[model samples]
Target: MKEQLVFATNNPHKIEEIRRQLGDRYTFRSLQDIGCTEDIPETETTLEGNARLKARHVKSNYGQDCFSEDSGLEVAALGNAPGVDTAHYAGPQRDAEENNTKLLSELGDRKDRLARFRTVICLIQGDTETLFEGVCEGRIATSPVGHGGFGYDPVFVPTEGDGRTFAQMKQDEKVRISHRGRAIAKLQEYLKSRSGADRPTG
Candidate 1:
């Protein structure tokens, strides 16, 4: 029997991305899979706190080995103003287009458009709690370029990528160099080290 691991998220896009990246090494469960229809509050002021908050909540409620990830975009020019508030940058509505428009306006015609995407993943199982982080250095594009990814993907161009927004790339290509992708790679490494396996079994 495959070991079950609960991924703390209700977003179908994120679920799909995680599933695609992790493959079939273990049986993955989402919030909906276990009937958790409520919103996991991300009230923390930082990414790590939010990730841990969700992970601990799920483990406490469902008593399962689970993990949660928080991601954000930080612009250098804005002194990372939207570091943790990237989701609701515009207002409480958290509209993606409004957020994008706000970001562009704030960064209007700036020569230094440097920015980066950061992700933090918190894993909790039994009494063990571990945190993994990943950073993707890139710059903000002048406008939303593609319609592929979620959040700030439309206006973010990775330094390592071929001058295209993450939203313009394929899922495989995006995950290969994305902050979430890198953080997940670290998670996989840590799990492999803990279990001496190729991929995470649970």
Candidate 2:
């Protein structure tokens, strides 16, 4: 496995989660550790595009093996209103509470609360990029349920689970099937098959 890999993100929660999943087998560093706090425009129209855009930017800027992810909460009733713009759904200045509230408001009067959390992770080394995707199907609860996870976790009740919101599940429990977890699993498989020092690959 690569000794050190960069994840192009600034969210500590996300970094912690990924580290917990990947563990000491590989060191996971973020934008701050690599001195890349500059704004990278997410001008892409799809999750895969945004993820690759971030990963490519980090690879070019830091000249290292970098990975990035773009995730979104898409509600079937809302016509996927917050797809790629999930982070900024509430407006230019995004707030989790605002975004969640807006989602609930828009979903009002709709009996079908179908929704899915989609995540796309892009692993990049120079011009080579590999994509892994995961989706968790669930329904939006009438109101927030727990205080554990972040973002829309409080309202997302997984279809395969015991009706508990993701925020209500323990970190380990959530990591078992969360979109990020699945993506990380795929990445681990790739790394295990190609274990080596961090050298430039043509």
lDDT of 1 by residue, 80-127 (tens): 879889889999898999999999999999999999999999999789
Instruction: Score each candidate by Cα lDDT.
Output: 0.91, 0.89
Candidate 1 vs. true structure, TM-score: 0.93
Q: Write the per-residue lDDT of candidate 2 for residues 1-202, one digit (tens) a residue.
A: 5588888999988998999999887787889999997989999999999999999998887897899999999899888869999988998787888888988888886899999999999998667899999888899999888999898898899987899999999999998889888888999888877665455577
Residue ranges of candidate 2 with Cα displaced over 4 Å: 196-202
**Candidate 1: deviation at residue 125, Å?**
1.1
In model 1, what lDDT does residue 157 have?
97
Point out the worst 10-residue segment of candidate 1 by lDDT: 192-201
Deviation from native of the Cα of residue 97 in model 1, angstroms: 1.3
| lDDT (Cα, 0-100) at 109 in candidate 2 | 69
The residue pairs that clash in candidate 2, if any, are 1-195
**lDDT at 142 for candidate 2?**
90
RMSD of 1: 2.9
